[model samples]
Target: MPRENLPEGFEFVASLPDPDGRVNMTDEIEDFYGKLDIDPVDPANISVGIYQWADPGLAYDAKITIIRLSDEEKADNAISNFKSQYDEMVARGLPIFSNATVNGHPSLQIKDVRGDNSIRYLFLWRAGSLVTLVEGNQDRNQSLELAEAAPL
Candidate 1:
């Protein structure tokens, strides 16, 4: 992820470590796919960037992960699968699933309530051969703002 394009008041924190030398998907990846009930597609490359708001009053953090597939076709397929799965979730009475256009790319905005009652916002979209997932501990609008500011 490019640091310069981050939203105003957001600062790059660190680059999270990738799963080490595994051909199969990691537990984290499996859990993410499990939530959507979709098979995980192994990415050719994965990049994770962590960011935090500079304002002391804001208690939100964003994690942006870009997964580059072997080709655009796979990227497209992955994004489509995510959209379909999210649609199913909405049909099952899940709250806060919507389609949006962020930075000119079609994105799915999801708000998930954890077991602890904490809220998480996710923005999923595809750009060329890259599939981006942005997760934040914030409101829907703030999550979209971060996704829009992201340099895909």
Candidate 2:
């Protein structure tokens, strides 16, 4: 399925394949995802899309995590939780925090307070019954543009 709303000249991948042309998810990726304090909506099925340039490059990579909640109420709760999580992070001295809109959906954008530019951008928003999270190492403007193009 064509999942995320990626901009022109971009596509989605199931996962980044290793040299063996296989996706090692459960053992490798899941653990790291778990470590991240910000998690996708819980107890809901998820569809993941790794966004990349059609021309391919390390610089043009991002991820979209779509959490399909079972009900509208669940989606609302998830959004609330997500906001609280980010609020807590800000309270803990996380510097960059901005609220914006992406294609009509309310979006929250955050960056590292420590001035580390490793993670260029992170965007979270709730659209209908889906809670979407976007992460990228690309430029902030590019990341926001990708989020704006999201199907949400």
Candidate 3:
């Protein structure tokens, strides 16, 4: 299967940039896998990438992450695990989920209030063996839009 790449206008950012400066990108799989508490499948064959684009023109910073598992069952289980974990948070009013669809795949549109003024939007979906997430610093709708663009 082909790996998913970032959409137009987005570039890979090494880390959260300091004052909006470019940083060198590095191999991401090991780090990402290490951060995961649950082993969805063997981590070696997973394909993943993180991309960011700061748009002064649109006035929003966008980040998208694509993770492809080995098979459909693994991806489905991962999505279900994610939903269960986030559902607890939703119960606390920290983050909430809205039923959405991305490229014909069921999606969870997540919203969280950071403070009185700051809000975060995250959209996640599973299509076959691939799972995609789009997050924006400010734009709620943009996250869903990016999720729809994912190659399912």
lDDT scores in order: 0.68, 0.61, 0.56
Best by TM-score: 1
Candidate 3 on 17-129: residue-level lDDT in tens? 23343432223333233323434444343433344556455444455555667777666666666566456677777647788877777778877555565677777777777
Identify the candidate with maximal lDDT: 1
Query: Of the pair 1 and 2, which is ahead by TM-score?
Result: 1
TM-score of each: 0.67, 0.60, 0.58
What's the TM for model 1?
0.67
Q: Model 2: which ten-residue window has the lowest total lDDT?
A: 27-36
Clashing pairs in 2: none
* Cα displacement (Å) at residue 43, model 1: 7.3
Stretches > 4 Å off in candidate 1 = 17-28, 31-44, 53-61, 80-91
Writing each residue's lDDT as its tens digit, candidate 1 over 1-152 gives: 65776666678886645457444424334323423333344554666777886565556567888776667777766666555555655787877677888888888887866567777888888778787888866567777878886767
lDDT of 2 by residue, 1-152 (tens): 24455565567765433345354433222412422243443422555567775467545556766676666666666656555545666777767678878877678886733344465687877767777777755467777877776668
Task: State the displacement of the C-alpha of residue 102, model 2, in Å, after optimal TM-score superposition.
Answer: 0.6
